[model samples]
Target: MEKKLSFRNSSFLLLFFLCAAGNVGAQVNPADVRYLGKMEGYWTMKTKLGIYAEKWKRVDEHSWKGRTMRIEGNDSTKMDDMRLFLEGDAIYFSIVAVKDSVGEPVRYKLRVLKAVGFVAENLQGFYPQKIIYRWKDETHMDAHFEGKQGKTTREIILQYTRR
Candidate 1:
């Protein structure tokens, strides 16, 4: 049979659990919250696909400038330029072909669906329906893209580090 907890014992156990969970009267200063936004900056990543780089800067209190570059293959046979904007509660990341040619960057738009410090969830207009961003730390993050459309499911993982 389960033993019933005494009133005092139950109260003590509840207090203990709250303390152990680190949720006792926690506080976050507004200044500290704003400080989290400082993470905006340029970052680069070395990858088997290419040298992928991005720049993020605050354009205003509620907007940001985002730029991306990709140099593909050892010979740098392919390059792309992408520029985007992040407004309060949303993002508009778009890919643009820097040069007109076959296999040029296809212009497309991406939107932010969710976000937290250093972490963001985005959806591209193309096949991929979901994107995840996980910050390894203040200077690094990992991104995962996954999608399934028309019998095709593609996924790409990328790492980004502060430049």
Candidate 2:
């Protein structure tokens, strides 16, 4: 009797899991996974600011994603935390601008200041920054960075193309 009851319980658990899986919406599909996969590659960058190229790599399966960007020539200066979440067809991202200093990382959170024509944002902190990006293609992008450092406020426009 115990053996029979155990088999029945196992069958019920299997059926419940199958039904639960079917009901969960927004579960990433094969094409979504494919698009996510395609994001991993080298990207060429052109900007009025100073820094040149940015390399992107898909370092996660879902939920939390990470990428690293290093300035050309100088290996010392690098920006980390290019993280984003996927919702429908749009990708939402937040990156902390950490100076290449030898000490602890300085954190900055980018928030949406406006999204009228193209999405734009004023970063949250004492030293605030604004960032805007528009999709050039399915795999290409262009962005603008503007911020205040110390007593100076500066702006830069940059292009990013996936390779």
Candidate 3:
């Protein structure tokens, strides 16, 4: 009877310490986990038709998820679902558009060029060859997309304001 009680007490203490260690491990910050923290929030851009809004949220220590939509008149249409995550030393940005619902997501690699912003690129194709994100302020940013269309180079700039 005494041996049985000793065995049970040993097992219980082992389990308790294991659980406590796991809780402590969870508190450790992962590598570059908070790199995208500045981008988390509700943002909007005004267009001629109406408004385009984007929402970004931190899903975990290493990932941020975003959704974008366009509101025109009284109708709202989902634009895309975006995910940004840190892997190894690189940050990946993926987008799955509503129109291309069945295909693999378009992916870009983001490289921090300076303290103010990063540049993302997809070298596999010409449609969205490069994208530059620069912060005008804490509450405002400009995203510039550069691509090729037939024989011409095209660029589009999107101005975003935190809402």
TM-score, every prediction: 0.49, 0.45, 0.71
Candidate 1 runs further than 4 Å off: 1-39, 72-125
The 10-residue segment with the lowest total lDDT in model 1: 112-121
Better of 1 and 2 by lDDT: 1
Give the least accurate 10-residue stretch of model 2, judged by summed lDDT.
108-117
lDDT of model 3, residue 37: 83
Clashing pairs in 3: none
Q: How would you encode candidate 1's per-residue C-alpha lDDT over 1-163 as one tens digit per residue?
A: 0112233574445434433332333332223334335447877777666677766666565445566667666543323344434434334433453222465533322322212322122333354455444455778755555567568777666567887
Model 1 alpha-carbon miss at residue 111, Å: 11
Q: In model 3, where do residues sit more than 4 Å from their true spots?
A: 1-33, 98-102
Better of 2 and 3 by lDDT: 3
Mind sharing the TM-score for model 2? 0.45
> Per-residue error at 22 for model 2, in Å?
35
Steric clash pairs (candidate 2):
none
Please name the candidate that would achieve the greatest TM-score relative to the true structure: 3
lDDT (tens digit, per residue) of candidate 3 on 60-160: 88888988888898999887788888777667777765122346777676644343555666756545677666556789865666678578877766678
